[model samples]
Target: MTSETQERRPLFKPVRGVTLAGLIGALAFACGVALTATSGWLIVRASERPVVLTLLTAIVAVRAFGIGRPVFRYVERLVSHNAALADLTDRRTAAYRQLVPLTPARLGTKRRADLLSGVVRDLDDEVDIQVRVVVPLITTVGAALVAVVTTFVVHPPAGFVVLGSVVAAALVGWIDLALERRGQAASLAARGQVDRVAHLVASGANELGAIRATDEPMTWLAYAQKNVEKAAFAQSRGRAVGVALALAVTGVATLAMAWVLDGEVEAGTINGPFAALLLLTPLALGDVVGLIPDALGSLARSSAARDRLEALLTQEPAVRDSGSEAAPNETVPHLRVRDLTASWTGEKTDLGPVTLDVAPGEHIAVTGPNGCGKSTLLAVLARHLDPTGGTYAWGERDVRDLPLDAVRDGIAFVDDDPHLFAGSLRANLLLARPDADDTDVLRALERAGLGPWLAELGEGLDTHLGEYLVSAGRSGAESVATATERSISGGERARLGIARALLSERPVILLDEPVAHLDGPTADAVVRDLLTASAGRTVVMVSHHPIAFDALDRVIDLPAVTS
Candidate 1:
């Protein structure tokens, strides 16, 4: 890796707020240990019929430690969680900015939904390391040190026992780290595969069942699940060993401390009450030391997550903006592709050596069989993918020389699957043109043939959509409103997508099989409305259906490539 690349890699620096939280947590653990030891000493001393005044100080101290432990823990949780959440928000924004240039191309062959889900999961895991792994590790180490030093001050031999037990626990933690590291990669891969399969099966259930291919995806899901289980089982062995070793070491240390105290008390080297406190110290300290092994496992998982995120974000963009080019100026942009060929991966050409020219306000359709690169051609034209060979020009200037945002702002792309967020009808429409008023949205809707539907709505633009309408129980006016929102058909969805594109006011519009999922009649009507609505713009659509071929000014038919 180049020095610049190395410098660009994300590093998790310790947050001051989190460090403070960890310190508080360490103090809390220490307080708990002191409370246990002090309480034991108080009880044993009281058994000898000591005066009430003599027990007063130890009683007050025990009560204070007991109360401080929970209070400090609560404060630690609040500070650490807030710091982690704030860090998560900043990292998510930066990571998304890095991912924008890599969309639909460098994000790999996995389903886009799966890839995006992985990014969210990995980012969450990475951020959680601060709270789950880092803070706990710091707190454990700090508390253990305090326990060792305090016990050593009371009884030198007992202090050494506590130190030896801690060293043994550290060795166990090291072993846990090695075991987790061995399975981390495999575990991550299995998780990704399971996520991919689960997303595919859920999102495409209807389509797969329609084609009777449900069994195939289910088989793949089962295989992925088995691998995930296997990895989990293998990783669990390390945790099990750590837990067993912790218990055994604590038992041995407690016994050793008790035996040494017995001899000290018998020889009059220490008071009977003080011996009780010294004997219970190791048991209290064991609680803090036991956390280290579990924290190590969290460290391993977070490390894996960070590595995956870095691997994805470090890739070079498929299309780089020259950064020194001027915007192209054309009232109605004209496009020319001469012998253009492109690839998702540079190793194989998926699109054309074929050529075409699009004049201003021209309506053209590119039709081809599946895998014949119609969508690939549209992707290249939309500047989402870069051409490996040939020249693509906009208004007589090479597109590669134009600023990326300039080119993108002049063109609008509507894909086969357009997302509808859960919001009011007005809110959904305004996403296309945020500054547009209700009148502008209605005009766009009418232009795309939703005039009749809009007129029939009782709430007009205020009608609620998405999950609320689907799940809510309704009566009277609510029932009517629910019916109105739920009445949107496949044809209306296509028109809504076109309406959004129209609101962009871009001179060139690219549609990639927008009506592919509709029935024949609905698809034909949608295509007709789209062509009518976008009459003044240059519309280049890719489709295999012959619904609106007669309406298009020209049609380009792509032939299949044979090796």
Candidate 2:
């Protein structure tokens, strides 16, 4: 997902195999209709005492149609499915490209499950439309055209009946689209209601319990469920109405074809055997038209999904991508900031308008009250964001002149919550530097004050650490309960973050309240260890504990913004 190479593609663009799939699907349906008509004609002709030899061609035609129908249908499915899946891969990659600029700063909580889920589900639904609606609709239209044309050549009046049936079916499809569009609003409202209640209950459970309103959420939940039911029922009704109206149109067309064939046969204008063929062709065409209503319903759903996706992906990145590929020359560059200001929302001042500077290997601490932009400053320093105002120079060149990726290569950030992926201890460190080996990992662990902790586990680099690990007291805590999947107390966890940062060996390290959740003693210990381990490395740490300020080279206290 963090990959910078972007081959962004249009979300709703047609995939390559769609046309070929449509043609194959059309031929498959056409074969079925032809088989039905030819069989009907053959049965009628046989009833007139025709010789077996006379029926040979009709028999062979029926056999060919039967086999061809499934064959073409199979081929169509193969092509359409492969194309759709391939497109999904490309679209997912593009979606990630769009999301790269929004990470950390723009998408709060670091990993936004809701936003990610919405993107995945909506993109999938959009891609599904190509298979479920577009290809099938094309097949239906093509098959109907073939049926109508052949029937018309046999008898113009019969041809008109088939065409009329198709038009009526199309009208039913229009009705389906209207109903679907109307229901979408209700469905969205219901979903929103459900989400609101669910979030309120999940995040405010303790508050609700204190207020003795635990049952209130149940009431809201029921109400939300009711709305969901209503929306679902409305959608079902649209499908029912479409199918019923389609069948009614089919019946009318069948009767009209029968009447026209009767007139032609009576006037000696059509043979009795051939009249059966024309009559049944229109009736067989009902299958083709019958599905249009549902296809349109699918189209409506895809359109809604596409609109949402467009709204999300179309947002301008909060940061300007310099797109510079130039590599940084200095191992530890001098940092200089002049009247620098940045905003997360791009609408309000989130950080700075203050001047700051630090020579290589000089450590600094930024202390400020909440909303004074401590974390925002870290984000800007990490090049995750663009400053709305001011200039920050690294190595005497404006940081903006450096490629984001190139500049980021020299920076490491360890925040309050450092995510530990579900993997081995070695794998977690490798995320910072994939090329780092066992010796490098061990060296980094030693530097971050995790060497004693690692030795205690006995698993060495193979020791597994998953989503969350409660860190025991300090390094080499006696008999800290160890598990194959998760082990390590809060202090150990904090040091692991430091180890990763050290592993990357970035020139500058930014700590965003790294011990915000740890107890005072543990937090102070972790902070002291980080500063000691960070010798000769430029470090900017955001902290509230004054104990931490004593060891820093300088402290910048940010004032609260006035309303």
lDDT of all predictions, in order shown?
A: 0.84, 0.82
| Per-residue lDDT over 77-97 for candidate 2, one digit per residue giving the tens place of the 0 to 100 score | 999999999988988888888
Error of 1 at 182 (Å): 4.5
Highest TM-score: which candidate? 1
Please give the TM-score that candidate 1 achieves against the real structure.
0.91
Mind giving the per-residue lDDT tens digits that candidate 1 earns over 1-563?
A: 32114354343466658888889999999998899889999999999998899999999999899999999999999999999999889878888888888877788877556577888988998888889887887788888899999888877898998898888888878988888777787787898789878988998999898999898899999999999999888878877877888788888889989888887798999998898898888888778878877788788888888888889988877887767568887888889999888888777789878699999999999998888889889888889898888999999899999898899888888887666667777888888889998889989998888899877666678766543323222355476455632545667777888989998888999999999889988888888888898888999999888977899999989987432
- Scanning candidate 2 in windows of ten residues, the lowest lDDT window is 1-10
Write down the lDDT that model 1 would get: 0.84
Cα misplacement distance, residue 98 of candidate 1 (Å): 0.8
